[model samples]
Target: MPELPEVEGVVRDLRPIVEGKTIAQVALSETVFTSHDAGKQTIVKNNEPHQFERLIQQMTIIELKRRSKYIFFQLEKDGETFHLINHLGMTGAWFVVNDITEITEDKFRKHIHAVFTLTTGELLVFSDIRRFGELRFIKEIEEHPPLLKMAPEPFDEDACDFFITQSEKPKYRNKPIKEVIMDGQVISGCGNIYATESLFKMNIHPGRKTNRISRERKQQLFQVICDVLQESINSGGSTISDYRSINGGAGTMQHRLKMYGKKQCLTCDTTTKSIVIAGRTSTYCPKCQR
Candidate 1:
């Protein structure tokens, strides 16, 4: 799953290439999922795929923004403006190609579920091997259920306070700090990998109760979260598995991870340990993170 840093990196790489460009054509594989709204029950089916073409063909992309792990495209057609939201599920990736010929030569074509033909003769392709990704067209992004329900981005100034407040609440107070931070409603886009890394950096155990953390320690944890996320973005995000930049390149941050996948602590002689919290594998240094 792509987290804040990976999605942020995608937004940065896509803005320059897709902005100001008109959609010459839109091609979607039948296996690709499409929805008119954010609800799972509102899935488009049967001949509805053609409806996707009808709604999006020739629409111009004005801007691109990332909300949580979702990609938003500000689109225009005639005088009407709408939004396209993409959720890259598990194995999804976007790539730009010079032409359709490049698509055939590319190794990932078999999984290329969606392609946007640009006026510049370039092809923007989205490939998802597992087909868990989604493409949605919504008239108002703010009112869309998914976007509407998301908490503020982790980089938002109020996010730290929000985390602290949420931690003190009964719903989250007794939960493991790792699980608390991983809640998208508490803090968006802080996934398993980054949360583990951040907690390790703050010398906080992943299994610590959220309410057990002191105010000062919470402040440090908040800063560590921001620092780890920003550093991951700077390093192009971790590419532990399926994540890739728009240019089909792997992120370097995985190589720089301190505790997420480590067997031993770099700071101390203590061995690292793994446990499941919120159903995700968490790694931490037993001696360093307490």
Candidate 2:
């Protein structure tokens, strides 16, 4: 799955190409993006049939925002009327090109499922071999999922408070730290990759209970989570699997990983091991993370 860092990388690569441009065309294959919010999809297609056409030659993209893994485009046309929200679920990605290049099955091969053309003569493509990505139109941005209920981005006071509140919850107190972090309600956007890396950074056992976690350790965990996430973004995100930047480039962060997919610890050179927690694989160094 594309975690927050990987998604952030795509956002960075996309902003420059799609920011000031107008949508020229919108295309979708037979598969429809479905979830708890099924109604919005139709709303998007109906409300903007001409879609990128009007914007292609007229409007300008004012700003871009991300909530959890969803990316929202703030289109400015005299005032804030409507904006486009896109979610790249697992195996989904956006590709930008400078010309009307022919999209061969070889480009993304079978992964190319949707395409959007911009007025700047650039082609914005979406490829999701699994058909899990979604696009929606919104009059009010907060209707989106991550923006609607997710905790603040990383270090906001609201996010910090939310983190503390979740960590202290009685029912979750006995769960392993990785399980707690991966709990979307506790903090959105964390996945198996970050869950493992964050615990390893803070030297906390992945199996440690939330109740048993010390206040100092909690503070440390908070810092490490932010640090690790920011570092991943700076490094362009990990691309060990289907993840790729919007520019069709691979991320280099996987080279700096401490212990996610490796069998040996990068720090102490001990053999990395794993155990099952909350139905997900938990990897760590027994020597570094107690």
Candidate 3:
């Protein structure tokens, strides 16, 4: 899954190309973007193919932003505004291409399900092999329950405080620190890969209970998470699998990974230990991490 850095890269890449430009055409090859909240799969939530076409075509993209792992497209036409919220679940990606024939990657070629041609003469293509990606067009983002319930962005001034307060809560105190940080409602945008790296860097065991750790340690871990995420973004985000930038460039962060999928500890030279937490594989240096 594309986490904060990856999603932020997409937002930054897309903002320049899509914002202030009207969409010229919207084409779907039987494409359906789903919403876990409504459990419906049309183009977006309630809009059918034709309806979605009518709603988005010719609307100028006002802005593009990222919250957690979601990409937001602010659209407007005739003084009416609507938000297109996209979650690139699992294998989903957006590509900028001048022509579909320019695509050479086999995964993107095979999974090019939706195409949004902009009036600027460029094309925005969406490819998702697993179909777990979501694109919803709504009046406002917070109106959606799932989006509404999301924690503040990790860069928010109060995000660390929120994490600490949530960690000290009765329900989360007993939870593993790995799971606590991975929770979207607790700390948005840090997922399994980033959390594992953060824990390893902070010398904290992934399975350490939240309450067992001191408040100072928790604050340190939060800072480590931010550093790891920022580093990944600087490297264009990790291409753990098929993650790519809008220009179809792969991220180099995977080459710099210290944990997550390592066999031997780079620091202590001890064999790494692995566990399943929050339904994701977490690897840590046994001798290095406490």
Number of clashes in every candidate structure? 0, 3, 0
Tens digit of per-residue lDDT, candidate 1, span 77-169: 998999888888877788889865564425467778778889998989888766677778878865566567677888888888888888889
Q: Report the C-alpha lDDT of model 3 over 1-290, residue by residue, as the tens digit.
A: 89999898888877877788888888765545333234555435545755676778988889899989998898998999999888888877888889987878888778876788999889888888777777788897667888887889888999999999999999899999999999999999999899999999989999999898999999999999999999998988998777777867778888988987899998888999998987888899888887
Best by TM-score: 3
TM-score, predicted candidate 3 vs. hidden true structure: 0.93
- Tens digit of per-residue lDDT, candidate 2, span 1-290: 78788888888888876776776566654444342235544323434434433443344667676767778777666664567777777677778765434444354645665566667777778777665666666667566554566666775667767888878888678888889888777876788888899998888889988888886788778778888888888888888777667756888889888889989988889998899999988998988988
lDDT of 3: 0.85
TM-score, one value per model: 0.91, 0.83, 0.93
Error of 2 at 188 (Å): 3.6
Selected candidate, larger lDDT, 1 vs 2: 1
Q: Please provide the root mean square deviation of candidate 2 (C-alpha atoms, Å).
A: 4.0
lDDT of 2: 0.73
lDDT of each: 0.83, 0.73, 0.85
